[model samples]
Target: MCWQFPLLGIVVDFGHYFVHRAMHSKFWYEHIHYVHHSLNDGGPLTAYYSHPLDFLLGITAPVVLGWWTIHGDLKAFLVYVFLAQVGALYIHSGQSWLGNKWHYQHHAKLKRVYGLFGISDFCLK
Candidate 1:
């Protein structure tokens, strides 16, 4: 059961990566995802400061995908959600030490670094 945590994270992160990438599409970005990009120099609170649709796409949808696909014990889902939110906050915190410098690049450049863990960016690029 414990081992499932990593697997669940991978699945959820994969879905999150794609959804985040999709949000960067011109149509999506202009209509929805742009709300998030507005916070170019954002802090932790900016993690949730997104258009409702962007939130759904960038956050909720990924969790839902994990819920359906992994459907593990409740503990796993809870841990995933917790970690996901924490990671979101960390990425949006504008703290370089958090280790995801590419996220900052995403906000700054808007054409690169479209994924959460960088896996999608690597593959899609």
Candidate 2:
């Protein structure tokens, strides 16, 4: 069960990476993800400030995937949700601390660090 937490993180991170990568596409970017990207100088509150479609794809979908894969383990689900929200806030806070600079780079450059864990980017690249 303890080990499952790490596995859950990997699964959720992959989902995030896949959806975030897709959101970069021209169609998705223009129609959905553009709103979130508009906040280049993002803050913590702006972390989840995105279009409904963007939220569905980039946030909720990954959560659902994690929940399903984890066999509905409430503890694991809560932990994932908590960590993901904190990570999102930290990344968007525009503060350079403890490797959060990657997300800042994503907002600044719009071309890199599409994953929370970098797993998808690493595997795909």
Q: Which one is best on TM-score?
A: 2
Please give, for residues 26-56, the per-residue lDDT of candidate 1 as tens digits: 8988898888889788799988989998788
Residue 5 C-alpha lDDT in model 2: 73
lDDT of each: 0.78, 0.82
Worst 10 residues of 2 by lDDT: 1-10
Q: Could you tell me the C-alpha RMSD of candidate 1 in Å?
A: 1.6
Please provide, for model 2 over 1-125, each residue's C-alpha lDDT reduced to its tens digit, 9 standing for 90 to 100.
56767887778788988898889999999989999989887789889889998898888988888879878678867877887889878878877867877777778799766877887778877
Which number leads on lDDT? 2
Q: Candidate 2, which segments miss by more than 4 Å at Cα?
A: none
Candidate RMSDs in Å, in order, are: 1.6, 1.4
Minimum summed lDDT over a 10-residue window in model 1 is located at 111-120
